[model samples]
Target: MKTKERKQEDKINRDLAENIKQVKKVFQDCSDVIYREIQLSEHIQGLLVYIEGIIKVEDVQQHILRPLIEGLAQHPQADGEIYPLSFTRVSLSQAQSATDWPAVINGVLTANVAIFVEGMDEVLLFSVKGGSRRSVTEPQTEAVIRGPREGFTESLRINTALIRFKIKTEKLKLLDMVIGKVTKTDVALAYIEGLAEENLIADVKERLENIDIDGILESGYIEEWIEDNPSSPFPQMQYSERPDSVAAQLLEGRVAIFVDGTPFVLIAPVTLWQLLQASEDYYERFFISNMIRWIRFFFLFLALFLPSLYIAVTTFHQDMLPSTLILSIAASREAIPFPALVEAFIMEISFEALREAGIRLPKTVGQAVSILGALVIGQAAVQAGIVSAPMVIVVSLTGIASFTVPRFGLAVTVRMLRFPIMLLASAFGLFGIVIGAVWIVVHLTQLKSFGVPYMNGIAPYVPEDTKDIFSRVPMWKMKKRPSDASRANMQRIGKSRPLGSDSNEGW
Candidate 1:
């Protein structure tokens, strides 16, 4: 059987007998496909159709059954009439085509009724779907030091509502589609109606409609599928657990996607600099923000190339070091048999293994395992001369560097790429390090996040955007919107001296 089954090809003047007959054959053996045939007030005969798990029976009983069924008792004259009812009076456009199969599935999934009648050609839909969901709670990742602690939930509707609560403007438009034939996942495309560029909106919608994946378990699947370059290590879309971040992006005219079953929402048309920014940067004082930004930048480089630099510097460029420093390094390496490359790889890979194991194991045991394993192994290796004490120091610093990256997903990519760069540095010394950095930079320059260049505000030189890239300038001085993703309406808030502004102050 196909994943999606349609009950009706198109509207037909209903012969209740004929319609019910067709619906049953298509829904064969589906016990949850409930069909409750009853006269509305026993006056109008119609059938209520809905799948079981997707709806609340109590809502059906209270709103639908109690209203119509109880009303029937009050008006004995209307009993079993089957021709007319006041509830039918609510819609003058009752005869209009209800919706397509996808919409029907959407309504059913959301606890709606597809009411079928004897004479009406189109179905009447009523939304009543309800189920218990966890109330919006603080984000585990991307925790805030200030502002609303609530984050996106697994429910896509709830997530949209969270965004709507923050930005109540009518310009906040939600465009939706179904992806993943098997999962039939709900994907929402949200952007400000006026602020979002027409071309960018159209491009995003086009890409989504064209996707034909078997299942979209989370937003990452959609992000990966729609990205411009599949082989690129960098993320084109930024994922966030915070709704305010998404709201901020939407206000700036970037599109946000919320996938069902995942709390993390994906913000498209992002930049490399955007990934480096932590929400905390906005909350903190500017001086602290700038300091933190530079610190993160320093570590980001260290994370990417520290081990390789250590290996290359020690093994291939010993002459590059001063006499005293060279002797100290030579004394440490005097007993070890392995070259810098092998020594670095052994310690780095071991640290990585411990880090990964800590995450996968239970919270109680995972931390213990990682800590004990690292301490014990590093001590033993140094004592046995399998690796030098300095080698342990280098590996530890590299691990710390990876943690300093702001975005977790980007940090992961950094970790995965670290090895390859280390390999090259080992093979060709300092020359390989420069070649690797150049290759990464070249690849980044070509990558696009949605239609916006990923490397923009850094490369191709937009000087104004630079203030917000490596460091967060005072809010008043950041008078313009980021020009990277935005082409129209670049100046968001007016520029003024940050010196005297109440909201703008020293870190």
Candidate 2:
């Protein structure tokens, strides 16, 4: 009985709380000193503790110092003391303890400094949590031709405010959690209370509570760690850098995880449709949006399979291509000694390399690389016969197709998964490509983002969730919540809009 109780106590001890000993214990063996100091004064006495860099210097000086300095000027006291402040009540997490580093780190993550009062062994935890965040600006990746121009900033508070500004619903609830032992990364789980399912909430919270990473730099860490099958190359979590995208997810009853220091917020559990979707689709006319959506969907396959199809057709399925086209390809590869696969690898890898180098290089050099890559390399390679003209065409088409994929993570995955499919097709022809595709589908079917099915809605065939999936149905027509999110309130818009429901007058 005693052993069981001790085990239970240990479990409780490790959980998040407003305790000093636990925090210090949590952050132990650190290079930085986790100091706990107390100074007395005639006016007031309190604790002053902080980690370097994490806290803003001016904020501590102006807000924390002015009052404390004035109090010390009036009230002179010894090092060992305790006193209360008469300033405005600051709303934040407060705790008392002096134990372990892990617990201390957790305390600091809660945006509190460890303070030990003179008389009391109990420590004081101040709520002065402020971190440096990037300024809000236009989203570079998700840039829109005609839509809301604002993008999400790195600040969690600002991101939440953006969502709040959009939905403006009391039902929108943000549940905050701190993950990682050393880093103590701030993670906020935002969802609509009525719309989100209780079970899913519990499941998400439970899964998060189980995380044991040392540091969490971005939402990707949480996404990678919490996924049901991390081994799968396909991304289970849907990530977006735009506020509108996150707002839309929240409206669909999906929970958004906001990690400090990253503009990207993760939404789960998502279907494949969510990853394929671009926020720009909804901002435009419905007809145009549907057409673009179809184009993107078609090109996504094109990007993934174009190169492989070229290799397979030239190697095995020669009859599939037109005789004229065959002659042109034959003319191109006639000078090249290497097979289709080798030629493809040389050009594709060069293109990918040039693409990566361009991003890393300065503006002048990058633009030069782009021009050289799109024009110089392909043309030069075809002229030199290092890669066939047909291979160059196939790689060029694939690159363009990849550019059209809206989701950055999924786009990267598409680029990554392409090479293997190319190799397979080179060996076994069309049969190899089919096998690779089957493998992807089977893996996707088994994958889960935070325990939510990856292929939900489309595969399971939930009709209610189809409104915003492939095509952006008219706003008025999307009357129900997306089903995969397992929201509690399935109905979104009823006979009335919640905003203007309260009428002014009968006249």
Candidate 3:
């Protein structure tokens, strides 16, 4: 009975009297949905509907309400497009002639005012979207010293406009669609036409269109649905709040997915190496960027394998350490009651708990809490003989190493995989650690992101595309985009000698 009543209320009628009743009933108890009825002319009337916070009050009064009251409705036009009004632009919608009631509701909800005239069987959609959207701010998580500071905000149009401002090209195409049956959220798929592979674009579009969910609250939802390897610990899609980062990826022939109401945008056909890169890498000098790149690469391995290495060496291969170091480690562990594995698990879990608490708590207090917790907990655990000093040192180093990773998603993956590797090391010592490492490598080799290999240009190996992989090379030396991400438009620049400019200047 309730469902029937709701469906009936959604149906718009030609009779103005009946339509007003149905519209009011459908939006019952929703105070934000405002309705204003005005006598357009002596015998004609019009109903204006919009959400309270999403629209500009002055625009409605000046553009919409003024023209109707001034006698434009004296010769009311049946076609909304031809209807002369004070408004600069208007779109005509035939919602009364369709079953897509959700579209009509969504248009109004997103700041398009709906006008239903007394005699017309259609609604005029006016665009006067205005609200207190967040201004562009620097991305906190992906801060860069040399690159542009502006970042994507929760507003989808603003985010897209940021990208458009950077690219400034007709080749950049954005395909829009509405996802979520209940939420009816807007989603935009962006890519460069000639650069991005045709198959990649089609694959991304297909995956997005096939998603059958009640709502997509964030880009993560679409990412989980569309990922080629959902079970893999490695993130198949990259996320960034920086518009410059997105523009760079688009130029490399990868597609970007923009979801409404979130700052994070999803980039597809991402590789493990790409996730490790920072926007500043391209902004700074090649030598400095390469040094930072090498440091990140070293820390990545340290974060993943440092704890496991300590567990394996201390438990089964003490000979791997020097005589003095072995003696020192043994003395440090003398008061410890638990074995190496148990001590590691306890300290690692404690560190993880503190890290999470730091993130959840207030910013000023979070840092202090995490710092004090680590110092107090580590010292107390050692004093109580629950954990050894050496184990504490290992965990602290591993935790520090994890933070060095550029992407939080990859850092999380590393953190998760650390425990499993530690468990394997506890069971079979160094041999088990090796086995875990091998398994991880094999899994990465098989993984793909929207049909592009997750380990692209490495496991399969592309020589020409390796210039900016491990280290940043001089810009003049690099002339082609990554082959794996772009099958077409591989050439980036014309070939030239580094000193050709000097010679051409007649020096």
Candidate of highest lDDT = 3
Off by over 4 Å in 2: 1-47, 51-53, 56-62, 72-125, 450-452, 496-507
Best-to-worst ranking by lDDT: 3, 1, 2
Q: After superposition, how far is residue 389 of candidate 3 from its true place, in Å?
A: 1.5
| TM-score for each candidate, following the candidate numbering | 0.87, 0.81, 0.92
Q: What C-alpha lDDT does candidate 2 achieve relative to the native structure?
A: 0.74
- lDDT, candidates in the order shown: 0.80, 0.74, 0.86
Kindly list the per-residue Cα lDDT of model 2 for residues 1-507, writing each as its tens digit.
997776544432322233345445655776554453323454334456577556665666665555455544123238633333322233233435544444544666566665533334344456565666577889877888887878788777888888889998898998988888777777898888877788777877888889998999888888877777777777788888888888888877778888877889888787778889888888887889999999999999998999898899999998998999888888877899899998888888888888888888998899798867679878887787688777777888888999999887898899999999999999999999999999999888777776667877777778877777777776666788777774567777778644643572221
Report residue 119 deviation for candidate 1 (angstroms).
5.9
Residue pairs in collision within model 3: none
Q: What would the per-residue lDDT of candidate 3 be over residues 267-329, giving only the tens digit for each residue?
A: 989999999999899999888999999999999999999999999999999999999999999
- Winner on lDDT between 1 and 2 is 1
All candidates in order of TM-score, best leading? 3, 1, 2
Task: Give the per-residue Cα lDDT of candidate 1 at 433.
Answer: 93
Q: What value does the lDDT take at residue 39 in candidate 2?
A: 37
